[model samples]
Target: MRQTRLRPPRLKAGDGVTVVSPSWRGGEVFPQRAARGAADLTARTGLRVSISSVKPGLCPESRAGRAEEFNRAVQDPATRAILWMIGGLTASELLPLIDYEAFGARPKVLCGYSDATVLHHALYARTGATTFYGPALLSQFAENGGTPELTMDSFAELTMRGWTGRFPTASEVIEEFVDWADDSRPRRAVPALPRKALRPGLAQGPLLAGCVPSALQLLGTPWLPDYRGHVLAFEFTDDNGYGPGQAARDLWQLRHAGLLDGVEGLVLGRPRGWSDAQREQLERIVLDVCHGTAFPIVTEFEFGHTDPVLTLPTGVPVELDNTTLTLLEPSVR
Candidate 1:
């Protein structure tokens, strides 16, 4: 069965973006930082920003309320894009409560990463609407030192217009961080090593991913998009240190579930904090799981939980030839 993917209308400067907290209510503790993200988004994208009335603490207090806010954003004709402020463990809980009918009716650009993967796959599976597995308001937009310049520039370049060709490569990476503990803390760049390509091959197909842990959480549930024929991507974000041992086990679980079956390819983002040995182990795990398959696999090609991140439209078709990955079309109308 060939599923038709939905493209959102292209967003431009002066469009409206609603910011909401789908998972953790970190915004309550980082209100000022959250506001900074809102302001930065406006200043940077020229899009008017409207944060949902549900403040962080009170908002997360009720999962249904968060879903309602997301519903409101989806229904509001003014909101051309919806950006999650940050991610947490429980976005999956909102899956049952989301206003899919309201959202599917007028789908537009909806973007986030990490825990937001729940929504990305669910939205794609249930509505066929493409969602972005990219930066979040507080995580990337409001990143200290003004979020990474490359990240902001790339986001603007990709989303505001149709993105094709090679995504701009990061000369530097954001591998470390200082907490957004205070509104007054100065934004600073995290340390990075230049991005590297770990494997080489060519493959093409629709995109499917979730941080390994999130993938495990959503897989076999109603949320995960069909894995058949997808260019599957996996990265892990410290749910339990996710060391090489843990990561390999997670991949094992995914493979065991048959979720990795018949994928067109597999791409991996940088595993944060992994040593050279751990990264080596991850490669072995990929080989172990995909031993007999022709699926091309590559690692550390950016596009998850990492800074200088690439904005990827979940469910969109992509081409990967070695480290050179390309989008097949503009993600929007």
Candidate 2:
């Protein structure tokens, strides 16, 4: 018998959302900014916001404490959802200590992206609970101006309103950052471009998405989701040492790992600060590495490491065609 994927409860007005720094202590480091995010999220979703405490440092003790906090949220009935403060390199450390049983018992909306990919994949692999790849408290909600309409709309529709249908693209895009200390206005926006097709086709399958390098961390682990028959969506962050060459190697690595085997479709997010030439170069590399594969390949679908992204739900079915992406099921119960 096939197992049914678990869907968390949908959020509603007056419901509570617990904000935890499973990765970095962004809330503690930037109280004002974090508060702004909480306010905006509340205004948009009508969910009460509560910030959970996180221990400082990457020591075993701190990681354990962070996991404990996450577990507390998981087991708390009052916390209808769990939201990450921000993404960072430290999130993978908490995976070993997460109370997967508690999460499975009382699965609620778990949302975040980037480093939180470890948590998303691990929890799903262990329990099949659906989690979201969406805005973070400090990163998206705490934007200099309020969170963009495209970001919030995607988030609220899927998580709170039980919206399911074709995902919309933003009319404008913003990749530049405004200093947190001086966030008195919004980031500059440029005309939005349509998704470019590297390989044209259509398919439908369970959605699996995350930041590229972060997802690679689960390569040989029990936590990584089975990539077969899934609509895989990946995005890259320009931070650290990521460049065209690195992107090319990562794509090849994923392919070699069999992560691309039996995939229904491939969706790539637009990396921040990517020039037209760089985008074309990466596309060429993908074509080379994935040569002879027939799965549909679409690039620049507007998610991850960029302003205005879709709040994608893992473990849910979605449809991907040459021109549009559609969620086949509601993310929450």
Cα lDDT tens digits for candidate 2, 1-333 = 112369998999999999988887878878999999999999888899988874455342388888878888998889999999989888888778899998888889999988988899898888888999988999899987799999999999999888989999788899777888887888999987788888989998899889888998988887887888888888987675787899988888998998888888999998888788988899899899888688999998888888887899988999999858899888899
Largest lDDT belongs to which candidate?
Answer: 2
| C-alpha RMSD in Å of predicted model 2 compared with the true structure | 2.0
TM-score for candidate 1: 0.92
- Write the residue-wise lDDT of candidate 1 on 146-173 in tens digits: 7677777767766787777776667666
In model 1, the runs with Cα more than 4 Å from the true position are: 1-3, 55-59, 182-199
Lowest-lDDT window of 10 residues in candidate 1?
Answer: 187-196
> What's the true lDDT of residue 149 in model 2?
94
Error of 2 at 243 (Å): 1.6
